[model samples]
Target: MLEQLLIFTRGGLILWTCKELGNALKGSPIDTLIRSCLLEERSGAASYNYDAPGASYTLKWTFHNELGLVFVAVYQRILHLLYVDDLLALVRREFSEIYDPKRTVYNDFDETFRQLRMEAEARAEELKKSKQMVKPVNNSKKQGQAQKAGFDKGNKKREGSSAAGATKKGWFSSMFQSIAGKANLEKGDLEPALKALKDRLMTKNVAEEIAEKLCESVAASLEGKKLASFTRVSSTVQAAMEEALVRILTPRRSIDILRDVHAAKEQRKPYVVVFVGVNGVGKSTNLAKVAYWLLQHNVSVMMAACDTFRSGAVEQLRTHARRLHIPIFEKGYEKDPAIVAKEAIQEATRNGSDVVLVDTAGRMQDNEPLMRALSKLIYLNNPDLVLFVGEALVGNDAVDQLSKFNQKLADLSTSSTPRLIDGILLTKFDTIDDKVGAALSMVYISGAPVMFVGCGQSYTDLKKLNVKSIVKTLLK
Candidate 1:
């Protein structure tokens, strides 16, 4: 039987996955295997199979050469190999109907996947029933005997029906009565509700551990609280969950960049804000957006193109600065970023600019030399606030990046106040659907609140994080 299906792009990004109810493939092992398959170059076959402890794994994939997409279906049970091709065709047809690679973000296709899963399961069920009906029956005498036995069983069942109905009715009545009579919330009563919430969070790409923790916190808060009535149970549980999420999101709410810039102007110095993150996370664009925001508030802003390593990085910042009509400081390619940053601050001060936004090279958190250089820039320049720019689609990977960056900076700093990430700026927020787990995981892991969310390509798209909006999104 078809147990599960997973679709992945060539980059090994999980586009969507569906599993039979109550049968979730262990995520880590499957992820590891899929990553291996994606990285493997020797295989030219369209299909592959592997044997594992609980289930047999089969991979059937179709590649869209022009789009560079690899559509993979993972079947757990042994079935005819021909069906795999049919399944892939179905997926490809459905994907083409709803998704446009250039226009639509892939993360928002959960509902489409749900519909596909429903159709696939229905087809599988029909196949199974057809197979069962094809089995031949025994002789007429044996059939007559089976019929007589079935009649006897049915008569006995009817005779016992009243007793069984009474028992079931009493049990259900007691359960509802207990729920309505102010009984303290128990694990049995809360498990189903919390599981649903946890599942919802997981579907949003939140890490399992984080989702479990959030649900646990909500469950703990609701535990031992007397339920006013069965009718009110859902609302009461939702309230508890909302309160828990708000608590996580509410800390460090005030960003107030304009106020800070004005204060710095009074002190005759430019306030510095540095943007840091891995490659292609919209650091330069977001910095420009911030500059536009500051410029709107009448704060003079200058940008420092400190990203000296990556080719064309400086020019990218310069382009954004030009488009925004803001001054930019660049020392050209291969120049020391720290020196550029320091000189930029000096220039901003000399120009009477209220704020300087320094753009740094994006390097992986594990890249030691680059990380050390980043720490040096932070220590040498001592920016007022160091913000980590993260991609919303990366989920827990963003958390890992922030944690390592904070740790690296803390290790490099000799000052009593280590240079920790002051806040996070999550880019591509609008590209994601409801899976706001990156926000929760980033804050919870790094202890840095989200300061701003970059929702769109426009300058006006940057908005401060709203607690109610975030909580509502999570619950929704």
Candidate 2:
């Protein structure tokens, strides 16, 4: 059963609720759905989840942009509610027909919702039965053999192609180059070139999914536009892709930490930056690097050793603090990292430190217990910046890590407005050379800008992301 459905305005006015859910949803998940996802331009996500003290809810939402109405459905976590999508669509359609912008109450929608729910459920049942009757095909061995046969033939022809393919080289590029006159571009005209561009991006370490999306976006932009004469379709496509990459890499929000730090210092509060990421991504080391960057600007910094679950995490941070000649805060291992971070922030304030770098344990995104702890620390401390430390060497896993981090933080937060990752710090930048596609993937996934990149093993290895140069290298 659907736990509840909500209809509201974009301005946060509730027009209708399926039931008086009361304090069961004490933290106000709808408000969170707005803050964490919709406000952050992540409404493209399939669904949102909120965990309460005694219950967990999965939320799916839809919007009528012209009508300025938001429709949401909430259900229990355990139920495989396949009909939620249908139900949301049904409500959106029926309600849009009768919606009044001047009205604030929608008491009459209850009956319409009841009938819509039953129809959606019936349609869902039919789909479920139809799906169960289908059987799996045992095509793996046949496919494997066919693949091997094709590979053998390709290898045999490789010698001949190497000798003659020199002239066949740029065969695709030649088609674009041979186009003499200006004409309106069609999808068919761009297909081969965009396919090559997409493949080129994949070879350069861009995630296949992101590469496909980027190419599709470029196609949409270039489709039907008048082409200038003598413009190679390939070069035009490349130029469009280049522009797209630069837009994606450019920071949407203010990522100027130095300015924010001074503003926080004027308020006499330490600018807290929480470093979080999965295992061995160098959270502590990069946290120290950020501290070093601040120190060079004459900002007093304090290190918060909140990686209490990991052995030697505190010692490692302590060593960095000693080398940097800054104060270090720790409560040893097996302590609540949230409290440790809280105390560390207070210590920074007491000592008049300009910034507090909170080093958290590197944890896999699916680790719920640890993720809850991380959420608690963010809620408890309300850090000025939550920088997710990711490796530039990653490929598709980069999106997975960044998306899961944002999702887990939104799902596990104790506050109605949970803090998502504000910025990203791409480590191991020197290792990735021109395969700089992970930066694009991470930024695209989280919609957070790449603020700092760690290029070497020293304290001064940190640098801000250069959008033009990275885009140039990506399209090179």
Candidate 3:
């Protein structure tokens, strides 16, 4: 359903649900209401009432004066938060913790957040003041020229000071905290947040180790600075940490290209690819997309619905097959996956298909029986490529999963002597942000060439892996 309107106001969080807007307003604070306007033309009462999540309305509060309140919201609360002042307040609060006698990752992240908030507020103020100043009446032409000059000056100021300061703070503080695992202050967040961080960093990658060391250095630096500046810097550091996380989780790149197929490659032929990952990580959707890509490129493609364990897996694959107008070899959900895979391979071979993509049951990497099932499929059909489709947003657990699966697959391949696996297919690249050092490190550690990346859930969102393009997109 479409939202009729977005109302903004300043007050406590309150909401009312009634059949009509007027009815909702009767019990509300009249002074706080900005205005009441008809959102849509309705004949009678609304008849249906829905209470939206988050605050009932957003408000333009005094950001700096109520900095602590805003920080509490931005740091720990919800909603699609977007406000210049709130960001600045967060930065200030978090930065203070960073420069305190104790420093920690929590503190570092908060500090960096503060710096960005400050930058945004400073820029916003410049624009606001510049637009409102009085102008001469007689010379309209001169006024235009004068305004342009003022804008240029403001732009220069932003470029020279505030912007640079924020960027510098973000970069340095993130780098420092990434190195320091421990600091003077302690983290008091939920265990899951900490566990998520620990799981991500446990792989002993270069970035993770460096981040641990950086935090320690920042903690040591707090010894000499004044309380105010220390607190401020700490906030900047905290903001940087959050930004780093954003960068890591968001995918800035797409994998969309196909490698040139040679006859030799085909002789070693029957290009079998397997997709594996946890549920809702775009596994089945990714398989469909791959099928579409292959058919588009004029390669004879067959999809094997070996994901017999999942209830909707076969039907979902069948849906894509119908959409693409391609052939699919699938057993119903109750059948053994190995049987499905074996039959699919035989069918593909009989049809002279160039590519046979198998969609497997989803599982966490540590599921031993699942791993055994995968091994059995590999032995029976001997897929040329085993692309583990992992969610980029999973943070550190993803790396551990990769490590476990890669090791298991390697061992199975050595013993069974089927066609060696080719590479990985990283799904959900769009969710990863620009500074995805952690995810990149995970890929590097996996030691598999990431062949494809999924930009979105749709069929056309899949892209051929290009490292340069990936880096550029994320940074953007």
Candidate 4:
């Protein structure tokens, strides 16, 4: 199935994207491929086609010289390269009609790109039906093979009588055996079942080690167990898998900001929460979403635009606050974020705000100075909770970010007690479709439960994580 289509400039800026596979292509996989192809093209390499390492989907890309653009398509199953070429041609034609590179910005053409996506989807359906109609028949070969087995009329008559007698006996025997086997569920059977489940998890993007561990937990729970009379093996295994995931997902799952704010109000202190993550992972927007969520609960909230490093960081948060009708605390650009954060909390206390949500500048994990600054801010404020906001579409990159952030922050804490990210706020979760490996991977890697998921642009889009629903989707 055609999963996603992305169009980007040669400079690695995404112009437009249509997601059919349910997950948005937000992070490293697309970035790495675009960077590599652009580098190869710059080096005079002819190849433009590339496959994502360990990805379940196939990626095909082509470039347009005049626009300096790249068109890439992702599919769950392989299709002819020529089909991708045809789709790209259609996309280019539609885009060219609406977009003038010299005058129109790419962001303004989202509606045009969306219409092109609808057309592509309709064409894909037609191609699928045509392929099915032209599928080669194999029934004749099967019949010939049966004839070659040499069953003459007399032999058939004799075999038919024997088979009829055997069938009656076999039915009774099979029923009895099935009943007996219900009480004899063994390790040998569990191993194969567990292996199948582990493979399924990996196909959905769960890390191999995490999948194996999950399977092991399932096996331990199921080994030497007795199946109920009406219960099937698959059903029993699936239940065990669900239970295991629920256990992993349930720890530290509470995200009742309103309750916490009320309690903090009783103490005359603002319930402080600091948001942290890498660049372009929707930290600012997500902070705004959280603010909106609090407002819905009838709690007064204030925002701290402590992300003073980026040129428009303060402005972005300011825009969200203004729209939400919430007050903001900011020290403008180039100021120390740690000082801004401290001042914001002080302002929140003075204003009698119930909660202060501090927005910090996004920094790469390997950027030591920025990482230290983040650690310093956390230490200085000692906030009620530090939440790591990450994109669910980035797969394991989200895991790496949380793991490193947790580790670095723990190391920098001066108190004998270790401090880690209390929970995760997974953004773009609604776009992930069936590939939910990032959620499992992040929890397994960082041992932090997901507090909230960002599903859309509205404040109401931020929702609490549902363990049962998530496990069902993953297993499905």
After superposition on all C-alphas, the RMSD of every candidate to the true structure, in Å, is: 19.5, 11.4, 21.2, 22.1
Once superposed on the true structure, which residue ranges of model 2 sit more than 4 Å away at CA? 1-181
* lDDT for each residue of candidate 2 in 1-476, tens digit (9 for 90 to 100): 67788888878888998864433454577777876666544454678999876788889987775566778998888898999999998998999899988888888888888899889999999999998896977769989899999999998899778868766776764566456544567778788899999888887788887788777667655665666767877888899788778767777568778999999988989899999999999999899899888899999999999999999999999999999999999999999999999999988888898999999999999999999999999998899899999988886686799999999999998777789999999999999878988888888777899999999999999998889998888877
Q: Is candidate 3 or candidate 4 better by TM-score?
A: 4
* Best candidate according to lDDT: 2
C-alpha positional error of residue 111 in candidate 4 after TM-score superposition, expressed in Å? 79
Kindly list the per-residue Cα lDDT of model 4 for residues 249-308, writing each as its tens digit: 776445676777788899999999999999999999999988888888888899999888
State the lDDT of candidate 3 residue by residue for 239-335, as single tens digits.
3334443433333343223453335145745567888776677778888888887777888788889998888888988998898888889768778
Candidate 4 — which residues are off by over 4 angstroms?
Answer: 1-177, 182-184
Candidate 1 lDDT over 141-222, as tens digits, reads: 8889999999999989897997888887988877786566555667577788888888877777777877777776566446
Candidate 4 residue pairs in backbone clash: 22-431, 23-431
lDDT of 3: 0.54
Off by over 4 Å in 1: 1-180, 230-232
If scored against the real structure, what TM-score would every candidate get? 0.62, 0.65, 0.46, 0.62
- How much is 264 displaced in model 2, in angstroms? 0.9
Candidate 4 residue-pair clash tally:
2
In candidate 2, how many Å is residue 34 off?
16
User: What lDDT is obtained when candidate 1 is compared to the true structure?
Assistant: 0.77
